[model samples]
Target: MINDIGDLLTNLLFATKKIIPVAIKQSIKDTIYALISIPKTKIYVFRLNKIISDHKKVKGYIIYPPTLDWDYMFQRPQQLARQFAKNGYLFFFCNKSYKSRGFKEVEPNIVTCGADTRKSLSAINDVIVYISWAGHINFFRKLKYTKLIYDYLDSLKVADSKGKGLFKKHIRLVANADLVLVTSDILHKKLLLEGRIKKTILVPNACDFKHFNIKKTINKNFEDINLIVNKNKPIIGYSGAFAEWFDYSLIKYCIKKRPNYEFVLLGATIGSSFHRSILDFPNVNYLGEKRYKVLPYYISCFDVAILPFKINDITRSTSPVKIFEYMASGKPVISTNLPECKKYKIILVSRGKKDFVNNIDRGLGLSRNKNYILKTQMLAKRNTWDKRFNLISKYL
Candidate 1:
């Protein structure tokens, strides 16, 4: 009886261990599915801005899937909505969560669908185009539209591990679109390789320079520097999301090699390990996240700025707004060698860790000149959001 009881106990323990791992794996899978489904669930906001403001009268309707509340994503839609309102066009934004947030009243031009079945979309004018994939796929496919535009912001298959299914959906949408607006040259090229016949246009990411340039001064007080480096020491700063594409390991190497320079990272921590490494560094200062308007002050404080992006599908196609912002601040810059940035000789490009270190050293040693400042300012002037919007306006 004792032997039989021991065998049963051992078998129970083995089963429990196996079951726990399976449960954990299933939980992770559910979380990832929820994240990916976000874009499908929230398609109303993006479409409304596109259709509302191009003309005095609303000619069409636009649709967008729900997107993550990243600063970059939210700011564009909000800005577009404001622009559309200024143009006096009817706009409607819909989301499943809007009702839960106590948003019941439909404002002048804006309509809130709340969590209603998307069947209401059928009543929308067939003269207007409908857009979206995945969650809105069935709706869009069934719609008979005058014109459809698919905005491909990123090549999801290559850029995100969890977005492979979404990428396939995008391909189908692209085939269905009357026009395809690609956000990167790389994405455009990829579509061309796939023999996509859609009318494709490249529209790189943009920044609101006027907003960033607000209340610019030669000086601003930052307290974080005193504990990490000398107050008057030359500051080399980087700001943005600390994601996997960021080469923090390269940053770590460079900071270790150069003790004289202060490295300021102004963004949320990506991982605990990265956060610990950065905080432990004597010369490194992590200032967490800051308001968008406050970024210019931090940029102004930097003697030089760095864009250390890891070479991946995401970074390869990425046209970082910070590059233009750094230029706008009239600070000399060093960045990793990226194809999109290769056209601009204004930025110092580094191939690897050794090259990055060397470039930063060179940039630090260079004398700041009025001519250099003026040139950078000129570049910044040309790259402003208004100019980019004008180019986009041509297509509209």
Candidate 2:
């Protein structure tokens, strides 16, 4: 009778264990539904959902498209934001989509705002510097800022939706800004034509020298060197996004001419019919997007770095970060004659298929020369992000 009682108790405990979780899960679901049914909670969530800003007062630099904070490339906005934060200023990165609300601290001094932040322009304290890209002109214009800086990061008129009147908005932004920063000479001239010549300053893109300057010790310590880097043939590499501006036909031509040269393209390729043809080439290799930290290892193995970009309105104003990065890696760069590339005398500028093919040979020859490598490295050292930041500091 005691053994039967023990078995009954054991079975009852086993049943209780199984029943408890199901009951708890049901209770949670019921509670969630009950909470959602409350009108005040729904209203609170709606307001919270719309806030996408850090309501911080500490000498902020407002950057539109908060996603730039996470970009591995650390473009102009992110680079400057980090420098500003390091110098005792709180950096507030505003998301482009102002639809939902919350704020996240992505870094020690950098705060990213979500869509739901309810802080008004007046409520935000110590916001002295306001810088914005072309797209966020109207959105940030209303904010009361002491110094309005318009950073023309790109030629928005050519890049954005054609019928959205974005360029028109850009005009108003230029006129309103206390200072205007253009990335290229083409942009500088454009701003001059708009009669904001005095305010416009050409602040070209720069590189993080320490990051890309891969030392000899790094090569020895790198374990994945043999796995990812192609050591068989002379590696001609290109890093950065393969967007519409990338000259695919020139890349195809280069592969056909120099079958002995192994061309490696890195970064995510935007969907294009031309991609399949380029990948089909036996001499060509595509190693998908790599983290910024490991990029130096790949670049270290390169014989020549290239910037084969199409000559168009988009390329005209682009001061490529890759050129500086390639130089910092101490590699010779063969590039098309984009306006910005021409400024760097170290770069071998190619104008056509014949020129492109010839410069690749010239670049390959230059890469082997120790003096040439040092020259390129010197150029990069001078144009470091810190140097760029110093120039920006004068205006502030």
Candidate 3:
């Protein structure tokens, strides 16, 4: 009963964005929220301690620190949690908002639960608590567990997205983590330079090959895309966030140069970084974000896939999952020379606007080459979430 009330105040501090001031640090908000619910916290701690006393015989348990809601755009947190559950660990992916949804069993071993969830569990002795967001530092003490792993997926240098205050949390998480998993070599190298490489491992992003490489024909349910894709012109496509880091200038150049090519975009305009003026062009089509299930159907329609991201510290650390999804679909991919993208030789790394546009034309021919298709698909098949889990499990 007490656990239920804590769930209301626990994730609500971060989840209910309109209620909380944007200027306040999430850690402070969460800390204050936890403090207010001391009675609830005591109950949760008692329940957890009682479970330890019982000595229940279970394999293990995995808990993800509260982040995005489970139903939101499926991302690394959800993907990795699924993998852990598949391996027999009872996994929980906590949400940051919509606590009213209650505890939802997403799969056989996996469930998405609301915050302050001591009622749901019977044990905490054999537990692994995984965290990606530095803001979750506030919950560290409250989440007493057997192991704590910090997945350093993104850089803290991107100042706009709570970087300044969270930087301190990053240091604390990295310093105290049982194991650290970095998604890219640049991140692994960063840890090395800082002399924090003792417990870090590189487990880069991967694709679900069987999911992306569709065997059956996709139904023509996407009525809106029919308006954009033309038989006369080739389709150059992109998916993922339309954020501040996206290279709008390069895409603008590509759109103007190839007037015949139809450019289709998927994903949401994150904050105010995306200017609507570019969408006004006749050839450019912004269809908004599709369900993750039907995302491949949209990708399969592309003659070429692109990652028009600004080469910055944030991108350098990012292992673009969309790039692999495009590869899995046997589509030729082009991108600005992000270190992660540049690692793959097949991905046409563009130096400047002219070269980026030129690559789109090259990609048209590359799409026809059966050998190119086979190699790209094979690369995607090789790097599955299952394989990524195998690497991570060894360290755990």
Candidate 4:
């Protein structure tokens, strides 16, 4: 009698001890499995659909750098890819670092592929967009596409030993590509001088105005902003990776020059000697990398934002996304005198260490310049991913 009572109670709770509908039992099993699983079994089912599902053939975009998802810092190629997906095109973003081998549909029209499927991309069709020239150039010939776009986002000169013959390879790739997009004026001029490709066009890096702008309301999710702002010191900020291109000596010089102001560096320390050593300084605050969604909140606390890049061949042709991001925050921006910075009226370009420090001081004073804010915000509004896609649609 005791065993029967215990079995009846257990069955009533689980709906498994007695006769029940197949769907109800299945739902209960699924609920139990979901509770125990890491990310839930349904997520795996959705990911598996990319490999087994019969997807319709449509216009496809295959981006080379593998960072196709929205998670990364939202670089130029990924931004454009998302825009294309929104406008009804199939997109495949390849990530060589991904542990899995198959492609998964992360969005409505966007599919992200892992390293296992790098060489097996026959499913996607149409546009092939190459962000750089260092990838396997020979394999490109095998892929059939209506258009091939080589977007020069970075200078290949700084690449490792594998990039030795890249100039010649780029010449060939440019010759083969239906359209060539250069991100900076320096790159545009260089391509023109080479005379290897005549169909090259300039499509500079742009801002996601909706995310980085000052007008956006801050909700409870932006708790980090409150913590940062509560510091109460005049904050001078830099957001992005601390790479070799970062001017460490200049940063150190500025820190010493402006001891009264708090200098904050936000982002990963990617093996840069200066970044590793600079934390020892008194006034410098090294806050590690923040997520992409919350970056605007952290940046909103900044009184003056900076782009202290070392001027070299690599940086000469660089079109930084941070300039627009900083501008969109409605904060004063002081940057190194890169060739591209000359085109923007809002940025205060510095010549050297003294100039950089002085400009930061000047920027702090001009934080409430409504005219300057309007100009930068207006410029940022015009230069967006939507506008860039409109230009790209011309060739497509």
Question: Which of the numbered candidates is closest to the native, going by highest lDDT?
Answer: 3
Every candidate's lDDT: 0.63, 0.73, 0.81, 0.74
Q: Give the higher-TM-score candidate: 1 or 4.
A: 4
* Each candidate's clash count: 6, 17, 0, 2
Clashing pairs in 3: none
Query: Sort by TM-score, best first: what order?
Result: 3, 4, 2, 1
Task: List model 2 lDDT by residue over 1-396, tens digit each.
Answer: 234554565555556776667677566555555555555434434543333233344455544443333444546887777777776666667654665345566776776665444243334443554554566665554554667777887777444735256777788888878878888888888878877787778888988899999853345555444433535677789998888888888899999999998888878765563377788888788877888768887887788899989998888888998999999999999999888989889999998988988998998889889999999999999988888878877787
> Candidate 4 on 7-73: residue-level lDDT in tens?
5554665755357777776676565554445342334445434543544554555555453334655
Candidate numbers sorted by lDDT from highest down: 3, 4, 2, 1
TM-score for each model: 0.71, 0.79, 0.83, 0.81
What is the alpha-carbon lDDT of model 1 when measured against the actual structure?
Answer: 0.63
The positional error of residue 344 in candidate 4, measured at the CA in angstroms, is: 1.4
Worst 10 residues of 3 by lDDT: 49-58
Give a tens-digit lDDT track for model 1, residues 1-396: 234554565555566775667677556555555544555324333343343343336544544333322133234444443443344434344454533321122444444344442444444455334342333444465545566666666547343557776767777778777777676788789889999945877766656666655433544265554344446777888987787788878999999999888888887655543546567888888887877756777777777789988888777877777777788777777999887777688888999999998988777765267688668767877876666556655665
Candidate 1 deviation (Cα RMSD)? 14.5
- In model 4, pairs of residues that clash are 66-94, 66-95
RMSD (Å) per prediction: 14.5, 8.4, 10.6, 7.6
